[model samples]
Structures are given as structure tokens and as C-alpha cells.
Target: MPDPGSPLARLGVSIQHLLPQRALTALAHRISTARAGWIRRPLIAGFRRLYEVDLDEAVVPASGFDSFDSFFTRALKPDARPPASVGTGLLCPCDGTLSQAGPIFEEPSGGRIVQAKGRDYSLAELLADEKAAEAFTGGRFATVYLAPYDYHRVHVPCDATLRTEIRVPGRLFSVSDATSRHIDRLFARNERMVALFDTAHGPMAVVMVAAMLVAGIETVWDAGLRLRPGRDVARIDFDPTVRLSAGAELGRFHWGSTVIVVTGRDAPDWVDGLVPGRRMRLGEALTGPRAPGRAEN
Candidate 1:
């Protein structure tokens, strides 16, 4: 467990608990969307230097972006992150630290992924849809945390057809590692976009969780999320024609945050050596061979 007494951890908790979350997030959104070169350029440069972002892989040159959001969610060179072999089962959806990865238990409703060493959040609250949560009741979940320097775009972990999309609005809490260790129901309490897909492995859900300072979450299909701070869950049914192959771009965070992937009980087992704090790139293998009796959808 992380030490809550540490200065950094203590400061994180203060920000999460004491700060005006929505106002701060709105300010961040304004700064991120600002087209003024004076504001965006230095902000981009400072962030790149601070986080050591690799501008070489970015599709647009650093000097080419008109807004911080453009550079923050920059596209990578096509070959930057390639897909794994077809039969490898599941692939990681983004570049980030694998904060938590394991089974989803049923008793409490949220599957068994840990938010921190000792803290856990329910999937039902995360998804805000009991029926959607049920599909992953006895399944698996992986939470990947993206830092400011990481690629903000997310991808499909497997070939799948979009089934449902849910926008669950909530408070925007800072999702830093320290906050995860100290804040209870951190992920569930934060605003998130849950997209359910019907894949060969079964029903898989890619949850885009918003963190403090994050402007918004956008998907390829819907550029405007229109997430209100206190609205009830907004559900969207997708046509079967909406499909994406493994490694295809799914969505992106305006600023870095976290993504949670949940799969049904029949999904493939995670590969050995995959553990908490492991840094993974997009398209890396996440699962091993399929378990007996588990059939592809």
C-alpha cells in the first residue's frame, strides 16, 4: 500500500476532497480548448518537457497544433503501436500503467478489480447499468491508468460490434495513483463512458473514466459526449453495423485519465507476467489461450 502520510499523497487527497472539482475541471477544459497560440504553445511545450512526451511519434508536429487538446490527443504514426497476432486472444487497449487486473466477483456487484492495494469499486456503479454489469459479474477487468505523457487515445481490445453505450455522469475526481489509494469508490464516483461490445470472446466493455482536469471523453462514433455533471445515465443503442477490429481507435480522453476493460466469464485468461504497475503499450497481448469450454462469440 502507498503511504498516505507522504507529502505527495496527502496533497492528492486534499485536491480530491477539498478542491472544487467541477470548476477546476471546467477551467482545464477551457485551457485545453484555447486556440490562442500564446496559451496553447507554452502549455504544450511545458507539458511535453515536464512529461517527456515523444513528439516524434505524434502525427502532427508539436508546433502545428492550434490548441492544447489537439496535441494532447494527437494521433501516432501508423506503425507506432501494432496489433498482436490474431489468435493471442485479448490485446491491451492503450498505453499506460496497468494499475489493476484480475477477476470480477459477484457478491458486491462490482467485479473484483482493485482501485488501489486495498480499495475496490463496484462495476454496477462504474457502469451505472445493472444489466450491463451482470455480463461481467463473473468475468475479468483490467484498469489502465494513463499519465499526462501517455497516448490519450484508446483502442478496441478485440474485434467487436458495438452494442450499447452509456454515459454515466458524476463528479470529476483526480485519478492519480495517490488518489486511488486514498479515495473510496474513486472510479465509480467519477464521470465515465461505458461502451459495451459483442465480441468473439463474449461481451466486452471498454469504460472510459474521466479524471479531474480531464476536459472530456470522445469516441470515433460520437465526437460530442455532452456529459453533464449530475445527469442520470444516458444510454445509446448502436446498430450492428457499428464494428471495430482489434487495435482500431475507440475513443480518446481530452486529457489523460483511466480506461477499464471488462470481459465476460468466458473470456480468455490473462497472460502470466501481467501484473499491477506493469507498463503496457497499445496492442500488447493481455490474454493467454482460451480456457476449456469457452467459445468465441
Candidate 2:
């Protein structure tokens, strides 16, 4: 017979996990395509106020937005951030609440991600690549969650050349703390766009995770890919020759979601202080060894 403690805990987690995904998905679709000027205006107003969105920074202020999708994925002023120097160790790629940021650690391969206090999920599932997973073994990781009021575009952390891109499609679940703590393998299960960029810091990967109502995630290189909420996984690869500058706009989320940066074991040791729940911004240095040979600058 199953242990009583195990069943009870699993039940709580399961129910807690499923509720947010359903409610948020419904909410996402309704708001994203909402056409009623009156209804949509109030909804957008509420989210803007709730998330404390900075209208001054938006390229198209909230009043100019036509739909919730536009409002959610609003662009920022070109001068909002200064250009990043390639010599700096690394720069943050987005403006969001640092939901969780730290090193990826587990005793064995295919180990779990530290979702919260007692939770962990698989590396293989997160990257959706067995060989690619090994590159990040013992490396660092940072997960940033974008709220409705945040800047939606993502930038490059360092000077890197595109190697490949894999679109691992899956369910679009809400990625709130309530969901993160309860959902098993939440990141892996969610539809995500993975871009593999090879850099001097080592092979770095930026995973643009999709959440409920986040209509889709598009990159500057491949702007045509569109995704609808569903259980599916797709993979796309690119030639290894395409290189981009540090802090270059790499991708954008149709609506708010999460962005994760994964670095391999070879990354600099100075990246020791980044922890979960910390805040970050684009073009700010994160970490890199000072040595010229090991540096990407």
C-alpha cells in the first residue's frame, strides 16, 4: 500500500499545481486578445497599476496600446539602458524579479532544479538535451521572472555566436511562486525556447520559458516562429556562425513569462553571489575571470 504521508503530500502538491495553470491560462487568453475598449482598458489599467509598470519607459505608453498583448509586451525606450562593454564578465539580459538565481547542483546527472526549499527538478528535462545538459554540469544558472509590468525584451549577456536553437514545446502553465513551489518539473513541462550561444565564458544557453497567456516567444534571428498553448515540443537548430554583440536584443516574450540563463562548469568563480529572489537588469556585470585568455572581453 502507498504510504499515507506520501499520498497526502502528493495530493496537496497536485491540486496546488493544477489550479494556477488552469486559472492563469484562462485569464491569459481573455486579456491577451480582449477587444472591448472599455473592458480591456480597465483590465490593462489594473495590471499596470498592480505591477507598477513604468509608462515613461515604454516606447508605446499604455494609453497607446491597442490590446492586452501589446500592453504586456510593450517595448522600452532605446536609452533605458546603456550599452554593455564586451570586456565585462557578463550582463543580465532582462528587467524582472530575480525569481531564483544560483548554481545548478546535484550529486548525479539528470538531477533536479531547486524550485524552492525542498524541491528539485531534472537538468536533462530543463535543457531537453542529454549532451547539452552535460555542458552545464556544475555550472551556474539564473532564472528571472517577468511580471505584467516588466520590460519584455531579452538581451544577450555576452558576445556569443549562435550555435543552435531548440524549441521544446509543452504545456503553458502559470509560473508564479505558488506554481513553482507546487509544480513538479515546472520549467521542463512548460513550453520554452532554448538558444545555444557559444562564448568565451563557455557554451551559454538562454531558455525563454513560456507561461499561460504568454502567446509566444520570438527571437531576433527567427522572428516567424509562433506558438499556441498546447502540449507539444519542437526543436530548431542554427548554423554556428551567427554572432551577436553583448547586450544585443535577442528575443521578446509576447506576454510576461520567465527567462533562464545556464552556464557551464567552466564559468568564472566570481559568480558566487547571485542567489534566488535577487533582482537584476540588462548590461550590468554578473561575473567573469579577470584573466585575458579566460575572459570574453
Candidate 3:
């Protein structure tokens, strides 16, 4: 595990978060504008070099990209990653480096879940809904961090029909590992979009966490998201009739950020040896099969 309190950790935290709050917010506003494409090119090139991104599998060749965010969230070839076989296990919903995975340690008061080493954020704060928080008490969670070069589009972890989608507005903090380690309540503090699904494994929450420099969060189901901006908390409730299958495109992060997937307590454990800092592709079985006769919720 990364020592979030070590001197090195402290240095990283400082470096990742050197920007002023207002400056970062201005950067986000700029990135969201059409004029930002000028800087996006060189920025994309620099990031590709810095991260040593593999372009071979990208859907649109990297050469085809006109901006950094465009390249960052580039699509993958259809066959580059195949979804896990049906009934296998939880799938990876996006292409990013695995940051951490484990059970959410519930707090004694307020039903908060510790997001990082020293930060405790409530499920209600994370989801912005009392009933939504009720669905995943003591459940499993996986945090995936998208570096500047990872694929930005998000897919489904399992065959889930979307039950409801909520947009919980909050401060936009940097979600990089450095920021996660330094900023208290990083994930919970960020502007986030939560998609709740009813899967075989019970209720699943796919949270697209926004960070500093993130232009916005967009969904395959809605285009109106592009028009909203500001710090107020927002929520969108859907009728029960909407459904989304696993491996389906849930949405895309305008720029890279962290994705947190939470499952009910009955959800099975992760496949052996899948740990932090690992690379995972979509459609791969993340967890092992359930014990016999335990059905997916």
C-alpha cells in the first residue's frame, strides 16, 4: 500500500496540489470551453510521452486526435478488450490503473465510508441520497484512477440495468494519487456523477468522480450534462423502467478522474492477487464466482 503519510507521500501530495483553488477552477472552466483545444494538442503530446501510453489499441489512432482530452478519453478497438463471459464476475468498467480495492469500513456515526487513510466521507455525501446509501452498507468498493493518458470512456462492470442516476455536485479537487493521499475527503469532495444499477450482484454504484481540470462528466444517456456548471449539488432521478447491461457504455469522463464502484455486502471477493497499481482491462473477471447457490443480486 502507498504510505500516504510518508515524507515522499507528503511531497507528492504537495506537488499534485500546488495549484490554487481558484486557479484550478478557472482551469476547469477554460478546459470546458472550445478555445482550450489549442493547448490540448501539446498537452496531449506531453502526456503521451510522460505516461508512455500505448496507442496500438486505441480506437481512433492517437494521430487522429486533435486535443489532449480527446486523446485522453480515446476509444479502444472493439476487440482490444473483450467483456468477461456472462456469469463470470464483476467487470472493469473503464481503462485505468487500479488504485485500491477492498470493503468500505463503515463509521460508527453518520454512516460514513473512509475514502482514504485519514479522510472519512459519508455514503450519503458520496451518493447524495439517503435511500441510495441504504443499498450498499458494508459493501465492496474498487477505486480506479485514470492517469492523463488512460482511456476516459466508462463501461459497465456487469450486465446491469440502470435504476437511477444522480449527479452530486461538490468541489472539484484533484483526484490523482497525490491528491487522494493529501486532500482530506478527496473523492467525496469532488463533483461526481453516480449511476445506480440493479445487477445480478444486487445494487451497484458506478461513481464518476470529478477532479480539478476535469471539464465535465458526460453520459451516454444524456447530453444536457454539457450545459451544467457551478458548485451546487445536483441530482437526477430516473424512472424504474430504464435498464443498462454490463459492458455497456455508462458514460465518459471529459477528462480523466477516479471511478468508484460499490457493491452490496453479498458481492463476492475479488479474483486472487488483483491489487493496487495493477492494470485491468474491461470485461475481465474482477472477482471470483459466488459460493454455490448464492445468486447475483
Top-lDDT candidate index: 1
Worst-scoring 10-residue span by lDDT in model 2: 288-297
Model 1 / residue 224 / CA error / Å: 3.2
Order the candidate numbers by lDDT, best to worst.
1, 2, 3
Ranking by TM-score: 1, 3, 2
Question: What tens-digit string does per-residue lDDT give for candidate 3 at 1-297?
Answer: 356667887776676555575467567556544335567666667777888988999878766776665676678888888877747478888878888777666666545654656666677778878788877887878888987677778888887778777777777677766667678777887788888888777888998988777777888888635523356666656765467776878788777788988888877677655577898777777788556765432
Q: How many steric clashes does model 2 contain?
A: 5
Tens-digit lDDT track of model 1 for 223-243: 554644347778889764588
Q: How many clashing pairs per prediction, in order?
A: 5, 5, 12
How close is every model to the real structure, measured as TM-score? 0.91, 0.82, 0.83
Alpha-carbon local distance difference test for all models = 0.85, 0.75, 0.74
In candidate 3, position 210 carries an lDDT of 84
Off by over 4 Å in 3: 1-19, 22-25, 28-41, 86-88, 110-114, 227-230, 290-297
**How much RMSD separates candidate 3 from the native structure?**
4.0
